[model samples]
Every structure is written in C-alpha cells, then in structure tokens.
Target: MSVGKSVRLFLSEGTPGGLITAEIMNWTGHVVAAPRSDLAKLTKRPEASRTGIYLLLGEDPDSVGGMVAYIGEGDDVSRRLYQHSRPEEQGGKDFWERAILLTSKDSNLTKAHARYLESRFIALATEAKRARLVNGTAPGQQPLPESDISDMEYFISQAQIVLPVLGVNIFRTTKPAKKSISPVTEVAAESGTESPIFEIVSKKHGIHAQAREIDGEFTVLEGSMVRKQWISTAAHTYEQLVPKLKQTGVVVDSDDGQTARFTQDYVFASPSAAAAVVHGRTANGRTEWRIPNGGINFGQWQTLGVENEPDTD
Candidate 1:
C-alpha cells in the first residue's frame, strides 16, 4: 500500500496559476514557483534572497517529449533570475516561461550546497531522458562533508516528492529505466506481484516489442525491436520522431540498420504515443498493442479490467 504524505501548498497571489509556495511537514526546504509573468511577485518573497538551486522551464517543440529545462544555482536566487530575464543574445535565456526555486527556510543552505544540488539535478535529468536539457556540460561534484552530503541527499528526496505534486515531471521516470535519478524517489517496488505484460509481434514488418503500464504510465521495455525509421514522409508523419529518441539514446539502430532496439525502458504518456514511435507514423496505439498468447488488444483489456477491480478508499 502507498503511504500518504501531507504537502501544503499556498497560492501567494490567491490564484492557482500565479505565485505559489510548496512545503512538506518537518522539512526545512521551501519551494517557490511562478510564471515568467509573475517575476515581480516572486522577487518580493523572502526565499528569493537566500541561496538555492532553481529550474527555468519552457516548451521544446523539437523535443520528442516537448519540454526543455535549465538547472542552475545561485547565492542570491533572485539575482540570477534577473540576469536571465535579458535577451539570449545579451547573455540571458529566452526559452523559459516558468521558474521553480528551492531554498532553505532555516537559512542553512550555503552556496556549496546549492552547487552540489545543481550538479545532481543535471545528472538526474540527463539520465532520466524525460526532457531535453539546455545545459552545455556537466559539472564535477563539489566536495562536501559526509554529514552535509547525507542531509542534502535527504533534501533532494523531499524535493523530488514535492516537485511532482507541483506538476514538475522532469525528475520523474519509470523504474525499469535503470541508472535513473536515485535520490529523486525513495519508494521500493512491492514484492509478491508484478504488472501484467503486453507485447507487439509482427512478422510482416518484423517488429517485436513489449510494454506494460507502470504507476499509470505506459512503459516500453528495454531490448524491444522497433521500426528502424518511419516508412512514410507523408503529411501525417511527424518530422524527426524516431531520430529524437535515438538522439537521447533511448533507442539505437541495430547493426544491420534494419530495426532499432530500445537501450532502456522508456515511458510514454499513452499507448498511442508508444505506438506512434514503434510503427513510425501517427498510430492508434490502443489497437496496435495487445496481450500475448491469448491475443487481446489493449482497448479490450482496458475495458475488461474494470469488471472486478478492487476499490480504493
């Protein structure tokens, strides 16, 4: 059973889309989030004056996942945001439409702590492959005492939990995708049972793929053979769909270049998105995916699942 943790959120401006604050009970970390339009409102907050690491996020039309983010740290959280408000040609990022800042409410976060957190966030984001990162290069780890490292690691765990509740998903990933953000989630996989498996087998186009839903997200498992490339360049075919997956190392071309193989388990928002990538053109995933041996399509299985399911309180 999943245990519940209480997270308190406050709408600083009395509106859901405006300035917001998020915090967990017994946690010293404080989160302040706001849209680019609410910069003035965020700057006035006391947390902005403290040392912290932050994320600047925006859309990436070219990204297969359609999100881009920059992770940075600053001694004065407000100062760095101000600098990034300028034009890109003038040494500022113009891509972001929102910002999420993480500072200590107890004023215990130092510049070193922030830098360490920044490095971990960058590494975790890259490893997850859930979004495109704008950072140019990775930074070497900053040396910190053993105790501080342990405490900061705990801080990151709490941040991971709070971030998702606030709608930041860059830190989230499906478990089968190994080498993931370890500090981002602490839940252990339950014993004695496992999720049902789904597969796609086709002899004509020579495809053999396997996927299953995990925690409400559909996950395409690793080592699955998929279409090497989109067969059509028609109007319905999206540009660079499979190429972007390759670019992120989620899937790679086979030695013969005939089919692609997934390097790791990858999550898709829905069965349709997974099917679209597998077959290489716009696809109706519900019909393309199915159960093995008995041969039931995903749509039918989904409908049948509700027949005798247990209820939640």
Candidate 2:
C-alpha cells in the first residue's frame, strides 16, 4: 500500500537552475541543492552551515551511460563543499557538478547522525550499483540508541523517497520506476504489481532474453542472452554500452562462449535500448519484444483498450 506524499519545493532565485530547497509535509529534514557553479551563493545560506550529509552528483567520464556519486558528512557542509570544489590535483574531487545538502529544520542532527547516514548511504548506493561510488571505503556505523536508530531508519526511508524526486537516484536498488500502475486486461493488476514478463528469442542467433517493464523502466532480467557481437549498424548511443556491460560484469560470456548472458537484471532507458542491446545491433523493441506464448508484441499489448480494434478472440 502507498499513501500520497506532498513535497514543497521553493526556488530561492525563482529559477529552476538556481538554488532550491525541498521538504516533505511532516519531515523535519530540509534539503538544499545547487549547481557547483553557484557554490559561493549556496555557502552563504544559513542551512549550509549545519551538521548534515551531502551528495555530489555528475556524469562519470570513465563509465559509459552511468553517473558517479560521493557521500560524506560534515558539521559545516559549505566548508566541505569548498574543499571538494577545488581542483583534483589539490587532493579534491573535480567530477561533481551538483551538490545536495541534507539538514534538519530544528538543528537536531548531530555529527554522529550525519556519520551514520554517510556510511548507510554509501552502503546503499554501493548495493544499488546505479552509480560508481567515489567512496574508497564504507565507514563503520557508530552505535546509537535503539530509538535513535529507529528514527534514523525512518529518516533514511524518507530521504530515499525524496531524493529520487530531486533527480538523485543512486539509492534506487529496484527496477520499478513508479509506485503505482493502472489496471489492464491481460491479468489483474494493482499498485506496485510487477509488469508482465516479456521475452525476445532468436534461435538463429542463439539469443533468448526475458524482460519486464517494472514501474516504467524496461529491464532485461538476469540470465537473458545477448548477441555475440555488436553490429556496425547498432545505434551509436547504445553500441558502446554493450562492451561496458561486459566490463562491469553485468553481462558475461556463456559456457560455450557462443553468446553472452546478463549477470544481473539491468534497466535500459527505453525498450529500444533493451532490444538493441539484446540483438547487438539496431532493432525495433516494440516489435522485437513479445509476451511469451501469447503471440502479442509489446506494441500491441501496451496499446490495449486505446482503440476499438475488432476483437480477434
């Protein structure tokens, strides 16, 4: 079951690209975010001086189609931001382009709490594998009172919910993109229900892959087969992703070394990317992917009830 959540966002500069603040209806946590270019202005904000955890986000030049993140704790977030804002040669990270600071409205968060959150977030981000973590290691969690631990856990859950809305998704460990779904005719559906399993098979290429559109992401399930090599005509955007997947261990060669299989369930930005990767070349995902044994392609199944096509049943 899911309940509605209200998030109040205020753009301090009255611009989407400028400094922004967010808060949940009943959450005491306050979030401040800004681009690295606005660091000077952000450091002047009162909340930037509070004890809190911060996340740095930017594209990873080293990894194709993924982002990099660094989680840390500080009594004065502005100070740490300045340190990281320096050049990498000065012992600072230069990869980040944006920063998000988390603090409490009542100033109740302490150094211990921030440290716990830093360690917890790092571990969570590592497990999610959504981004390459800049953290060298996960710090040990300090022991806190049982009640405080419970409170912080709730805080973490709330942060998880709020972060994604801010375009920060390093902690998204699951495939489901949205929490709810509309009812469809093939099978009874409900909120949070998994998408129907779909597959793409090509006996000629020795490829058989299973996938599902969880939430809204098109995810190729683990053990799905991929073509042996990407063709020259493969979509340029996703062509390099094939090798990157193999290098990251997301996909690996099978026992016979004839083709490859996905080591873990992987999400593609779209059905076409999933299809292109599975086929090792350019392909039409809507027509390529189909409901196994049902004979209906993705294009057909997804458009159900949209028109008054004569029933073939």
Candidate 3:
C-alpha cells in the first residue's frame, strides 16, 4: 500500500482559478502553477528565478479529449518562461495555455541536475501518453555524481506525488493495482462481507470481465479478456479506443494470436468505455454488468445498494 502524503497548496490570488503554489510536507521541492493569462504576474514571483524544470499544457486541437504538453529546463526559469510566452513567429511556444514550474525551495538544483530532470520528465510524459508532446527532439540526459543522482531520483519521486495534486497527470499510468493518487479501495458492500465482485459476459464475442466501481471509475480487474476485433457495427469510439489500447498494451494479443487479454488492472473513465471495449461494440454498461448471484445489474446496485435487487423482466 502506498503511504499517504500531506500536500499544502497556497492560492496566491485568493481564488480557486488563480496562481497556486504547492509543497509536500518535509520535501524540498515546490511547484507553482499558473494560467497563461497570469504569466506576467507569475514571472514576478521569487521562485520564478530558480533553476528548475517546467511543463507547458494546453488542449490539443486535433483530437477530442486530447492534451498537448512540452517539457523544458533552465538555469533561470523565469527567463525561459518569458521567451516561450512570446508569439510563435517570435520563436515562442504556442501550444500551451498553462505552466507548471518545479523548483527546489532550498535552491539545491544545479544546471546539470535540472537537465537530467528535464530528460526524464520528457520520457515519462511520452510514456504516459496522456498528452501530445510538442518537443521536436528528446532532451538527452546529463552526467551527475552517483550520490547526486540518488538525491535527484528522490526529488523526482516527490514530484510524482505532488504533480497529481496540481492536476498534472502526465506521469500517471493505469496499470498499477492501486493508483498512487488518493484511490478509493472500498466499494458498496454488505454489512459484514466484503464488496461483492461483478461481471459482464458476452459468450458470443468471448468477453468475460470482473469489475467494480471505485471512486466513480469502472475498474476492470486484471486478466480480463477483450474481443480481438471489433464487430462491423462498432462505433467510432470503439474503433479509436481499441487501437490505442493495443498500442498501450492494455489490449494485447494472446500467445495463440487468436484473441486479446488485459495484462493488468485497468480503469475506465466510465462503465460505457469498459463495456464498449469488452463487447467489441457500443454498449450500455449500466444494464450489461450484473451480479450473478443477485441478478442485479450495476445501475440498480449502485443506486439501491446490496440489500435490494432489481426486478427481473
């Protein structure tokens, strides 16, 4: 189990949608997040001058639900930020509308350290695939002393913990059994028994999944099987999702090359997404997944709890 962390976020502008500074208890790293509209005010802060790595975020114009990001490092974070704030014709970045600056409160990060962090952050964001990386080339790593390398790794770990708090999910992966964030483990259960397992089966398409609702996300347990191919009537969402899942290894070919399987626990934004992937077509997950013993589907179970069962037609 991951230990809980205490993160303190101070809103400098005294509003929910303004400049914010965040720090984890007992850690030297600090994160300052601000909107593109407040760049001038943000650049004036003291942390702006520190050596650090930064992230530029914006919505991707090409795809729905897609984000664009760019990662960079500098000896003077403020100067680099100012340069990027200019128009693209003026040699500035134009794809991002928000900036997240990561710096050390103790000013411990050196030029080499910042470069090393930048290289790793880019690689990580690429792996997460949560956003489109606007970088034209990879920022290669820099050599550091062995001791300093270890210290920087710890700093990276702290950043991983704090970034999610700032809504930076570029490093989060869905494969972990329990997410490092504040994941909900418990589900609606009986008075004394554990949360009952639920399933969605489609013998025709060869789908058999075990899942549970946790923190509003439909989490399909590890080892779930998905259709190898979408049916002819599959929706456009299914067409796009399956290929991306295969690319991400959430859907992988069987050893026999006949079907695909989920290698680890995967969480979907909604039940419909999980169902669509499972059935190889559009689905109504609320009515599709059921408790074999109680004969109640997810929709009723979630609203009425374990004591009540849906009336069968």
Candidate 4:
C-alpha cells in the first residue's frame, strides 16, 4: 500500500490474539492502509527470534537507495514498522517520509543487528540528501540510487556536496625618519652663547663618530676616534665602533695590525656624571677641546669658568 495509509491488520490465529491496525504516512503527509493478511504474516513470526528479515523498499519498488529500519525481536513486526511510519512517533514528516522498515526472518534479532540496521538507514538518508544537493535537484525530486545493496556495506560510501568559496586581503611596509644632530656651533648660537669652543666634525667616512664627555676625561663615547694616531675607546663601544668605522676607510690596527683590539679607555664615566658637573645633558667632546688637567671632562670644560689649553700647537 502507499505510505500514510490507515489499514486494519490481523495477526496469526495461534499466538498473541487480536488484529492490529496501522496508518502508513509518506514524507509528504499522505496516508494509506496496510493489508491485514500482510500484518498476519508479520505476527505469525516467532517472538524474540531472528528467523526472518524484511526490507521496506521505497514506494518506487525498484529504488535501491532508501532507508532501512530493522525489527528483530518485537512480537509484531508490522506494528513496529507502523510506529516508524507515523509522523508523531518519528522526528517529523521528513523522518517518516524517508524511513523504510527491515525485519529479520529468523526470530533471533540481536542487539547488534538492530543497531546495524538503524545506522545503515540513517547513513542512506544522509547520502541521498547530499546527492540531491550535488545534482542541484530540489527537495522531493526522485528516489535515490540503491542497486546492488549489500548488508555488509556502509550506506554513505560516496562523497556528498562541495563546500563554498572565500576571499582575502594584503598590505605593505614603511620606513622610519632619520634624526638630526646639529653642530655644536649651531646649538651654541641657538642658546646665544658668546663664542662656542666646541666644533662639529661631519665625517662621512672613517669612524663616523659622536661623543659626549665623562668626569674629567676625553672619553670616546661611540664609534671610533683617531686621537694621537691610536685607537682609544672603551672595549664594549670599540666592538660596536670598529665595524661602523670600517665603512669609512678607518682600519683598526692592533699591535699586530691583523686583528683589531678594542682596548680604548673611552666613556669611563656615565652621561649623568657629565650632566652633574656640566649644566645641561647635551655635551659631546672631540669638538670640545681641553687642557690636560682640566677640572671637568673635555665636554664639561667648555662650560667651565677656567680657560682651556688647545691640543694643537
């Protein structure tokens, strides 16, 4: 009978007396009746036995791809199938629409067999849905492929629908600006000083240097300085100073002249020391000349009250 059909059913005359009635509902809510004789055949089967197996084929009859629910131990297979076929008992109209009942012939339905049938039916439904999506077939199109069906095979053996597409964006990098170090003269002029003793040495090559004084010493602050024709700077600064100096034709000649020795005693004092003795923090030597025994460093001497002797004859 077609799905969703309300039909009176009769059981076997021997066991479990009384006739059973069931209404078969399709996926679309159409109802039909099941035959009483067929119901009787189902009831005659031994209870709780795995003796017989039945397949609920799609309405198309020839359709291979369809759901397959199993009824193993129930007294009335027909009644159980009817339960699955109901709209309210199942999840919804879609569930009953897709459901197909299967029963084992042998009255020995095991838990494992029932589970297997349940899983297979679900998988088949899922695959059918996916296939419809792939073919661009809307809902309620046609019966799914079910030829060469095997009990051992999984229902969703093939791939389903494909995923959608996406998009992305990109960007670029930028560089920082250079800092300006004005000459001491420019700074002194800006401050309105009488005569700025400090001079700015703009060396494009040979130890590109910048210096600030320590306590009472002419310390090589950073990079290298060619003082008295010798490399004299602190060891740490010299390591950094040498490579930068090399870029400008300034070669670090050790006692051996092969390897460079950063044994200079420059920057022995910190900038704070100079700032304490000198008024402002902005002080650089190399330009600020000084006498041998000046009270403060060369950079500090410039701001001192005493006169400074020149290094040049």
**Positional deviation of residue 261's Cα in model 2 after best superposition, in angstroms:** 1.1
The full ranking of all candidates by lDDT, starting with the best, is 1, 2, 3, 4
Cα lDDT of all candidates, in order?
A: 0.83, 0.82, 0.77, 0.28
Q: Which stretches of candidate 3 lie over 4 Å from their true place?
A: 61-65, 175-199, 208-267, 284-313
Worst lDDT run of 10 residues, candidate 3, spans 185-194
Which of the predicted structures, 1 or 4, would earn the higher TM-score when compared with the native?
A: 1
lDDT of 2: 0.82
Instruction: Estimate the TM-score for candidate 1.
Output: 0.84
Number of clashing pairs per prediction, in order? 0, 0, 0, 31
Write one digit per residue (lDDT tens) for candidate 1, span 26-64: 778999999999998787789998999999999997786
Better of 1 and 3 by lDDT: 1
Q: For residues 43-111, what per-residue lDDT tens digits would candidate 3 score against the true structure? A: 999999999999999997443226789899999999999999999999999888899999999998999
**Best model number under TM-score:** 2
Q: Tell me which of candidates 3 and 4 scores higher on TM-score.
A: 3
Answer with 2 or 4, whichever has the higher lDDT: 2
lDDT of 4 at 277: 16
Task: Work out candidate 4's RMSD over C-alphas.
Answer: 37.5
